[model samples]
Structures are given as structure tokens and as C-alpha cells.
Target: MEEAAIGDAALFHSEQRLQQAARVNDTATIRELIWGKVNINARNSMNRTALHWAAMAGHERAASLLLDHHALVDAEDKFGMTPVLLAASHGNLSTLQTLAKAGATLTARNRLGQTLLHCAAVQGHPSVIRYVVEDLEGIPVDDPDQNGKTPLLLAAESGHSDVLSLLCELGCDLQAVDKESNSALHLATRRGHAELLSFLTSAICSDAQNQDGLAPLHLASQAGHLSCVRTLLDSQCQINALSSRRQSALHVAVERRQPPIVELLLRANINLHLQDQQGHTALDRAVRSQHAALADMIIKAERFHARSLGANGQTGELDLTLRHVGDLSRVRSVLWALATRHQKPGDWKKLALHWDFSAKHIQALENQWTGSDSYKEHGYRMLLIWLHGISSLGKHPIKELYEGLVEIGSTDLAEKVRRQANAEQEPARRCVLM
Candidate 1:
């Protein structure tokens, strides 16, 4: 028993010595150890043999010495990482080539199911990646790891531009997705890989969405990646693509308070009137998030766009129109009459809902009450709410205001308001305030 215990200690010590020799590329000491008939495959506590140590240290001479001694080239460490995998990870081309030429399995994966290409990609080693991809035929080009992330996907996540360019040049699957169906474009955008995003021009980049229905632009906008957003926008991606929540990139930018991206989306003439899953617009979202600058920017952009389209509203001054609509004098007379007759402050909220003012927009408008009476303020807010709907519809606000008055039993005022648009189009005609 004592002799066996001594022998086990000697073996462990010899393995330790072998690791030390390999780390320094001491080929003479390694050859001496091999001549002593030392177990070449002996592993330390981490299950890593001398060749694993040599591969990790990038010692080509020591690695060659071990290989000449018939070292277990494909032996896995505790993590299932073979020497070739380690070599690729460290950018050791010579040692890696030696292992590959020695029949070291290129497809051998660690516990993570990552191949040499996956490691090379993640580490941003283009040379190693090129050899594994170009030199070695039949390499699993799109084989996924445990997370279903392919080599291209991993490269995109880390913003490895050159590696990605090489992969793209080699005709790799540009549309490769991860476990969540997030495409390479999705990851590149999310990580702000502007150059990489610019590299991908396939239709998948413009259309692929993750599990949440968020496209690459949505991720880029949410992450506040200005250049990435520019690349996506330049790629001619669907600027108004909505997510599962029916929210656009504009919504994401506003929610995240990204002003530059918001400006980009706004300049693209995105549908500001589009409602989200939560009944919010980009303007409303900006207000809800308390991003005062973003809110002002959204309002300013919408007003400018509305004017550029020659979409003048009846509200006169464009600023009075709150996000695509405003309260016309006709609706004002109706609400003004109701508040004057009934003198109820809260009652106007119900009428505001009747006009189809979004509860969110209405709630935003209701935040402030002015004048001596809340009823007057409520009436004013109700007028503004109706104007917003009227403005977005680009209809005759004056005509619509007149119709609302007649519907609410205020025909006397309706007849008077009808002449407001006599010089313009018909009552049913969609016209902005002119």
C-alpha cells in the first residue's frame, strides 16, 4: 500500500513537471520525459494533459514533441475542450495546424458544443477562422452551440467585423439565428455592430424578427445605437415594422429616450399615429417616460412633417395642434356649451372618450387644469382631444366640429361653424386645418 501511494504521488509530480515543460516550450525536457516512458496522456486535476498545456501556451515545439510521442491529440479536459479547440481559442495558428495535421479532430467540441470555428469567431481571430472555414472543407458552417448560436451568430454578437466579413465572403448563413430566433442582424444591431450590420445586405436583415417580433432596427433603436440605426435605415429595412406589441422602432426609441434615433425615424416619416399594444404613440410614450426633450422633439418633428405635407389644420397656429390634431372652434362650442350649461368639470372626460380620443392622450392632456373653473379647462382639453383625432385623419376639422355640434344637439352653433369651411372641401372630405 505504501509503495502504491508513493507511485501515485510520483505520477502526479511527473504530470506537473510535464505541464511546466510544455508551458515554456522545453522540447528537450519533454523528449526526456517521453523517453522515460512517462504516460503522455496523464492529466492533472483539470483533466488537461501536457499537450493541452502546450496548446494553451502556444508552444509549437513542445506541442510537436508531444505529438511525436503519440500524445492523445483529441483528449478532452475537464471542460471537454480538446487541445485543438484550445489552440484555436488562443490564436495559435502554428500549433493548431500541427494538431490538425496530426489527425486532431476539428469537429471535437467542448462541453459547450462549440467547434473550433465557434471559438475562433468568438475570440475575433480571423486567421484561425479562415483556416477552419476555408482550408478545412466540410466544416459545420452553421452548427449551433448549446444556445443554438452558430459561428456567425457568435461573431456578430461580439462585433467581430473582419471575421464576419470573411464569413460573409465565404457564403455563410447570414440569416443564422440563436435559440430565441434572434438573427445575426438582430445581435449585430443589439450590440451596435455598425460595420457588421452594414456588411449584411440580405432580405433577412430587413425582415427577420426575434421571438418578441422585434426586428433588427427595433433592437438598434432600443439600444440607442445611432450608427447601427443609420445602417439599418440605409439598408431599406421596414422603418415602420411593428413588434408583437404593435410598437414601431419609433416607439422603442421614444421609450428608451433615444433622441437621435427618434429624429431618424421621424425624418423617415414614420406613422406617428400608429398606436402601440398599450395604446400609445411615440409622442405619448415620450410624455409617459418623462423625457421632456424627446417629447418636445417628437412634437416638433410631427408638426414639421405635418406642415411639409401641406397638412395645415383649422386650429391656425400649428403649435396648438397636439400631435396631428387640434380642437376646432365647432367642437369647442359644443364642449363649451356643455360645460357652460351643465357646469361639470369631470363630465367632459366621458364626452372626450365618445370622440375616440385615446385614453392615454386624453390622460396626458388632462394633467394640467387652468382658469377659475376646472370645467372650462376640461372643455378646452376635450376640444384639443377632438382636434388631434381630426388632425390625424387630415379631415375638415371645422366640418367635423360642425358635425359633432349637430350630433350633440347644438345645431345653432353647427350652422354657424359650417361656413368656417365653405371656402374649403366638403364635410366628409379629409382635409387638414387650412
Candidate 2:
């Protein structure tokens, strides 16, 4: 009990000295405390030693003073984060350099499997990264953390072009992939950094493919990065390259509803009809995505090759010699062909069941039905009208619909539908509705 009491008293004094040193930047007082037999590596409630506080506050002098008194360089806080990681995260280059030179192991990983280099790269301190890369020998240039992201991959993903360039110069593997089999170029393209994408495209030409067989161009096209798409196209990348899923760049562009990218790919003579592993063509994907512009472009391209209507007038064949028409009739013919082949019964039912609406096909459908009146005179017209009314019912608001459903004894069904709709709409929130 007497020994325990003495140990407690010493710990109390150590805590006080650490707090005092942090407040006044008092290197002398800190040294005196260490000399007075206070534990040099004593951690407070947060498991932070005097060195951590000093480094966090950019107190290089105090940090140096502590180190001179033999403060533990590798002392970790509650998070297992060392002084070097904290210094790098706080952008204190001098303090980081001090810790490094003092034999703080550069290979130390925190609880998150992040090394000091990952922290420096993520914090965008190119100088710190360069110092770590150059000064710290044996630091793995391609070592990925828990996320399989190397420092170079993190730098590229975060749009740090200068850091990326430095990493490349230091022989960081340009082709290293993360958990998703995504290379640095994939991250660059996914983030829409055209300049970085270009640099990476030129840096690692062969290792750009991910597990999905998606190259940087396919990723850029999928993400609708028009400039990146153009850059990839102009890079002489194999325009006909297919993903592991057998999806071509054109297919992804159509699926993403990026008409500009579609146009650019078409100009490059990319096979517009190239299908994925599921045997669905680019036009099929465009129609599924409900992108009228892309569908029209594909149809026009097909007509330019003399392939008219396919079986059942649903699929169209190319007919190059056919004269292009700008009238409503011509537009109606195209919509009829696309909707018949692509829009299923379930799609029509969804249009009728949900109040969610898109005006994309309204004008073309009205023109087509008015010309022949077959859709109107036939039972299909009544079905279409009923669907339109149902689609417009819940437009007033979900709260209003909820009350209405309760009155009609359909509250349970309404709730179920609302939950399903919310789930479906989550990913689309970031998408441009048009």
C-alpha cells in the first residue's frame, strides 16, 4: 500500500508537469520534472504523452527537449497513433522530421493500418511525403494499408497530383490496385481529375484494368467525365476494349446517359452494338437507362447503314441509304420501336403504380398515338390513360397519399411501396434527373 501510494503520487506529479509544459511551452520545467523522477513516457487520460501534446501544438522546441530527456519516441496514444503520425497529420514538417531523425520507426502502423506515409499523403503535404520517402530508408513505397491503398493510390484518389508525381519519381508502383482491383488511374478517372488521369494514363499503360475488366476509359465513361472520356479516347486506348463483364466503353457511356461521351465514342468508330457478357447491346442499355438522346443517336447510326426494322418491328436494322426525317412521324416510329422492344409490362406497371414521373416520352408518345389513333382506339389506350392517372395520383405528396391510403384501407400497402421506392431512389439522389 505504501509503494502504491508513492507510485500514485509520482503519476500525479507527472500529469501536472505534462499539462504545465503543454500550457507554457516550458521545456525547462518539463526537463526538471523528468529529472525529478517523473515517468518520461507517462500518458494522461487520453493516453497522450507530453511528446504528443507538444508535437500537436507545433512545439518543436518542447518536443526536442522531451526527446533530449529520452522521452519514448514510439509512445502511442489511445488510438495507437504515434507522435510521427500526429505530427504528419498536423502538418508539422519540422516536428515530423525531428521524430524521424530521432529513430521513430517510419514503419509503425496505427490501429487503422495507416503508416506515417499514408497520413502525410492524405494530409496533402508533398514536402512531408518527400521527406518521408527520401529520408526514411526501407519504407515500403507500395505498401497498402487496410484498404489496400498505397500512398500513391491515396494521393491519386485525393487529387494530389504533385504528390503523385513525387511518388512516381520515388518508384511508387503506378499500377497498384486497391481492394476493388482499381488502379491509381481508375481512382483518378472516377474522381474526374483529367490532368491526373492523363498523367496516370501515361505512367502505367498496362496495369489500368481492375477486377471488373474496367480500364480507366471505361471508368471515366461510366462516371460521365466528358473531358476524361475525350482524353482517354484521344490517348489511342483500344476503343473496342471490353470489361471483364464484357461491357465496352460505349456501353457504359450509354448506361450513364452521357450523350456527349456517346457521341465522342461514336465518332471514334467504337462498335455501338457491342454487347456485354449478358448479350445486351449498347443500344439495349441506353433504352434501359431511358436515355432518349443516346437511343436516337444509335438508331440514326443504324439507319445510316441501311438496316431498317428487325423482327416484329421492335428492333431496327441499319439502313444507310434511308433519308433522315425530322417530322413527328419519324420520331414516333423510333419511340414505338424502342418502347416495344425494351419497355416491359413491369415497366408500364411501375409507371402506373408510382406517382414518380418523367416527361421524356410524353411528347413523342402523344404525337405517335394521335397520328394513327390505334393506341387510343385499342384497349392499350385505356390502359395507358389509367397508368398515367395512377402515376399522377401520389404527386400531391407522400403525407397526403398516406392519409388517403389510410382512408381507403391501403395504408399497409402504401407504407410497403413507399419504403421500396425510397430504397430504389437512394442511389439516384446524386444523379441528374434529365
Candidate 3:
């Protein structure tokens, strides 16, 4: 048992010395430790082999000595980063080459499912990425990380043009998509990388769809990339390609309220009425987005198209007027519906009184009902006289009316109506016409 304790002590001492040597870039100390029969693969408390420590510290000479001593290249530290991954992340080209030439499998993935290429690409090291892509041919160039993003996708997203070009030249499948059904084109468009987008558009066919059934053009439109949109349109790409949500570029444009993009798409003759997965057209999306101007434009365009069809038109003069009235009626109906649905008696009375007391209709009623003196006495005398007074004075006598009604101290039913009338009078006063 004492001898076993001594062996553990010796192993700990050797690992500590290797760690120190790596930190200080002490090549001689590293070689001497291995030559003196110290376990080259001995791990520290963190489970980091000497190669892991050396690579992490950017100590190429120490790392080479450990590699020469047959230390495990893919030995993971507690964090699961192998020596190759650490070296690649730190852009240690020499250490990476030594580890690779020592038969280190470049495909070793950490807990993140990130291979050495992923690390290098994420670190924006074009040379290290090139080394990994070139030297480690067995590593799948298009193999995705946990996020399902390949090295090419990562490089393009990071705007590492050189690395991106290399990946493309090596046939990295520029159209490979991530977990979001987002392709390299999608990422480039979303990141607003115009140069990378141009390259990908020119180099790769734009028909590649992501998980969303969205081709690159759809993504470009969704991202508001006008230049990318133009390029895709010029390529005769499917301008109205729909996503998994059945949303076309026109739907995305209207939803985003991008007028220029919408105009460009409209010019491209994209189907303006394309519906989404929810059976909502682009006009519906526009209305939902509250882009009133764009919605009006689309509505007018549809109306114009329908009118051009003559008698067989979807909308004739009566249909057009009805549609306009229907829109206004719908708005007013929603206000009334909300009032009734929410049990807002005050709102209901205010709206009802506003519509009832409108000057045009009230004057017409006064003129039409003047023949019956009883109706005239009730409507013309009371209603017209009060309306004339308010119109001339520009204020409803709400306070006077409240005081008069309260002074009478009427029955509970009359008092309730009076209170409701008083509660509704102020808002109605604002709507009163001069």
C-alpha cells in the first residue's frame, strides 16, 4: 500500500512538472520528464493530459515533445477539449500539424459536438481551418456540430471569406443547412454579409431549400436583403418560394413592412396574394403588421386587377363600394363588439349615441319627421334644439344635464340611465361636430 502511494505521488509530481513545463514553454524540461520515465499521459486534477496542457498553453515545443513521447492526442480534459481541439482553437498551426501527423483523429468532438474544424472555424482561424480541412481529409467537411452547422456554415457566418472559399472549393456543400432549416445563404443573408451572399449565390444554386422549405431567395427576402433579393430575382429564382409555414417572400416582405423590398418583389411579378400556412394572404400579414400604407397599396392593386376584368370582375363598382364600406363597418363593428364583449356599458352608450346623434343623419330625420308634430315635438324640439345648441356652443351641457337629472332624484331605473348618460357624455362631446 505504501508503494502504491509512492507510485501515485510520483505520477502527480510528473504531471505537475509537465504542466509547469508547458506553461513556461520549457522544451528541455518536457523532454527530461519523459526521458526520466514520467508517465507522458499522466493527468492533473483536471484530467488534462500533458498534451492537452501543452496545446492549451500554446507551447508548441512542449506539445511536440509530449507528442513524440506517445502521449494520447485525443485525451480529453475535464471540459472535453482534446489537445487538437485546444490547439485548433488557439490557432496553433505547428502544434496542430504535429498532433495531426502523430495520427490524432481530427474528428474528435467535444461535449458541444464541435470537431477540430468547428473550433478552428469558430475561432476565425483561416489557416488552422485550412490545415484541418486539407490535412484531415477523413474528417467530414460537412459534418455538423450539435447545432447541425458544418464548418462551411460557421466560416461563412463568421465572415471568414478565405476559409469559406476553401471550404467551397473543397466541395463543402455551401447549401448545407443548420437545425433551423437555415442554409449558408440564410446565415449570410441574415448576417448582412453581402460579399459572402454574392459568392454563395453565384457559386451555389439558389434552389436549395432549408428545413423551412425556404429557398435562399425566401430567406433573403425575409432578411430584407434587397441586393440579395435583386440578385436572386435576376437569376430567375423562385421569388415566391414558401417556407414550411407556407410563407412566401411576398408574405415576409409585407410582414416585415419593407416597402422597397415589397416594390421590388411586386415588380418581379411575385404572387401578391400568396397565403401563409395559416391561410392568410400577404395583405393579411400587412394588415396584421399595421402597415396601413402597404396594406392599402396591395388592396388597391387587387381592386384594380379585379376591375379590369369588366362584368366578370371579382369587384364591380357596387362591390368596390361595398368592400370599402365593409372595411369601415368592420372597424366600427370591432369597436362595438369589444364594447359588448367586455360588458363596457359606458363604451357601448358612447358609440351608440355618437352614431345616433351624427349631424347629417339627425338633420335628415328632423326634416323627414317634421310632419308629425308629436314626433316633431319629441324629436325636433328636444333633439334638434339640443343638437343646435351644442353645435353653436361647441360643448355638450353634460354638467348641467347631470345636475338637472340628479336634482330630480328620479327612480332607480331612470337614475341608472342618467348616470350612464353622464358617464358617456364627455367622450361623445369630443366627437361633437362644429
Candidate 4:
């Protein structure tokens, strides 16, 4: 029993040395070990043979020597990574060629069902990828692994622009998706690859959605990838494209608290009125998520966009910034104070009626329910919408506010609001007074 244990220990030592020698490309030491009749196929702690080390390190000559000594080229490591897979993953074209010439199965897949082409694409090796696709028989460029991820998708996920370009040039399917139905564009956007996203958007339809019905724009917006979001918008992707849940990219941005992306989408004339499957607009999402600043921005955007459409009767893109919206920017605080501090519950609906606000407009504003205080938000939103319309026509907001309040029988409140509007306070003082 003791002798057998000694023999096993000696074999482990020799195998460790052989792996070490192969790692450093020490051909002389490897040859000496081979001459001593060391077991070439013996595995170490990770089940990796010496050939695995040689192939991974790109030691072409050492790999050739190991193959000639009848080493197991297809021996899988603990992760099922064979010598050929190791070579391909490390971008060792010469070592891979050596393995291929030694009767190694070039099409052998790792445990994840990833082939040499998939590995090469992930590693950004165009040459190795080309060799695998062009030289290896029956190896399709669009072949999928266990997760249905093709080499093109893998390359896109890893942000390998050159490999992706080559794959596209080789006629790989540009619209191919993985098991989750995520396309290369979706993967690139999720990973925040702006340059790669630009390339992909130019190649494929930017509005292509994943299994979740999320387009690249939706993913970019939710992930807070500002450049990627801009790229998708510039590519003319459907700005108001809804997901499976019927949520637009705007809704996703607001829900995820992506302010910059939200601001960018608003500039593209995205539909602020788009409701999710739960019937919540982007503004509703912002309000529900307690993102007060984001909610305010959406309200401002919605008001201006409506005004622009009503005035022009044209649906072309319009920048909805505060500057483009006009004089309402000056009295935003006065309007806020009127809605939050002065107006009572159900008062906004009466004001809406007085201002000729359509039932649809009133309903849209009241759609969000956040308890009894919901009326405060509803009134605030309605006030902004009314202010936008009045400002767009170049009308005096103070005069309009006084008239609207009198029509609703709030004459006393109207006098106070008008006085506040006419007060010659500094900008800081105005904010404090409101």
C-alpha cells in the first residue's frame, strides 16, 4: 500500500513538472520528461493535461511535441475546455493549426457548447475566426451554442468591433438572436458599447426588440447609457416604441431614474402620453417612483409638446426644452404654489373646465392615484398644461390666472396669486415667497 502511494505521488510530481515545462515553452525540459516516460495524458488538480497548458500559452512547438508524444489533445479540463478550445480562446492561431493537424476535433465544443469560432470571436481574433469558418468543414459562422448565442452575438457582447465587422462581412446573419431573443444590437446597447452600437444600428433595424419586447433604445435608456441612447435616437429608432409591457423608452428611463437619458429622449419628441400595460404614463412612473425632478421634467415636456402640436397641426419633431416653451418658465414657482398650497381637492378639474381643458386632458392628469394627496399632483400637472397653452399664444400668464380663478369662484385666491406674480422679488426671493 505504501509503495502504491509513492508511485502515485511520483506520477503527480512528473505531471506537475510536465505542465510547468509546457507553460513556459521549455521544450528541452519537456523532452527530458517525455524521455523519462512521463504520462503525457495525466491531469493535474484542474483536470488539465500538459497539452492544455501548451495550447493556452500559444506554444506551438511545445504543443506539436506533446501531440507527437501521443498526448490527449481533446482532454477536457474541469470546465470541459479542451486543448483546441484553449488555443482558440487565447487567440493562438498557430497552436490551433498544430492541434488541427494532429487529428484534434476542430469542431469540439466546451461544456457551454461554445466552438472555436465562438471563442475566437469573443477573444477578438479575426484570423482564428476566419480559419475556423473558412477552413474547417461543416462549421457554420452562425452556429449557436447552448444558449443559442452565435459567434456574431458573442463578438457583439464582448465589444469586438473588428471581429464583428469581419463576421458581418462574411455574411453572418445580422438579425440573429440568442435564446432570450436578444440580438447583437440589443447586446451591444446593454453593454454600453456606443461605437459598436453605432456600427450595429447602421447594419440592422434599430427598433428590433428582444424576447421581452425591449428594443436597443429601451435597453440603452434603462441602463443609463447616454451615448448609446443618443446613437439609437440618431439612427432614427422608434422613439416611442413600447415594450411587451407597453412601456416606452421614456417610461423605462424614468423608472430607472436615468435623468440624462430621459432628457435626451424628450428632445427627440418621444410620446410622453405613452402608457405601460398598467396604464401608467412616463409621468405616472416618475411620480410613483418618487422622482420629483423627473416627474416635473416630464410634465413640462408633455405640456410643450401638446402646445406645439396644437399650434402647428404638424407632428414633426420639436425640441421641448424650457427655453422653447416660452414665458411659463418665468412663473413656474407661482403656478406650483397655486397648485400645492392654495388649490383645494377637485379644484383642478373645475379649473380645467374653465380653461376649456378637454375631458381627455383632465382624465390623463387624474389617471395617477397616490392616495388622497393625489389631487395635489393632479392639480399641479393641470396647472402646468394650462400655463403652457397660455404662454404659447403669447398671452399674459398673470392675467389669465386671475381670470381662470374668478371663473372658478376663487376670486380671493386669484388676487393673492396675481399680487405674487407682480411682486418685484429677486429670483431667489421669488422661490422663497412661493
The ten-residue window of minimal lDDT in model 3 covers: 317-326
- Pairs of residues at least 3 apart in sequence or in different chains that clash in candidate 1: 312-433, 313-433, 314-433, 325-387, 325-388, 326-387, 326-388, 394-431, 395-431
Query: Candidates' lDDT values, in order?
Result: 0.77, 0.68, 0.65, 0.84
Worst 10 residues of 2 by lDDT: 319-328
Model 3, position 212: C-alpha lDDT score: 62
Candidate 3, residue 188: Cα displacement in angstroms equals 3.0
Residue 309 lDDT, candidate 1, scale 0-100: 64
**Which residue pairs show backbone clashes in model 4?**
none
| TM-score of each predicted structure versus truth | 0.66, 0.60, 0.54, 0.76
For candidate 2, the clash count comes to 11
What TM-score would candidate 4 get against the native? 0.76
Q: Which stretches of candidate 1 lie over 4 Å from their true place?
A: 1-14, 28-45, 133-138, 309-434
Q: Please tell me which predicted candidate would have the highest lDDT against the true structure.
A: 4
Which is the better candidate, 3 or 4, if ranked by TM-score? 4
Off by over 4 Å in 3: 1-50, 65-72, 101-103, 112-114, 122-126, 129-137, 140-149, 171-183, 224-227, 256-269, 293-434
Maximum-TM-score candidate: 4
Q: Write the per-residue lDDT of candidate 2 for residues 1-434, one digit (tens) a residue.
A: 99999989877977777766954679878877877887778778888888888777778889888898898899998888999888887778999888888989778888878887888787677888878777777778788999899999888888888888888888888778899888888888888888886677676773358877888888888888989888887777888889888999989888878888887777666786687998988877766665655655664454333221323443333322213322324223323432353333334334323432223333222322334433432223223333223222223233343444455555554464345434444465522311
Candidates, ranked, TM-score: 4, 1, 2, 3
Model 4 spans with C-alpha error above 4 angstroms: 1-8, 307-434
What digit string (tens of lDDT, one per residue) describes model 1 on residues 269-297?
77888899888888888776766556555
Please give the distance, in angstroms, between residue 262's alpha carbon in candidate 2 and its true position after superposition.
Answer: 3.2
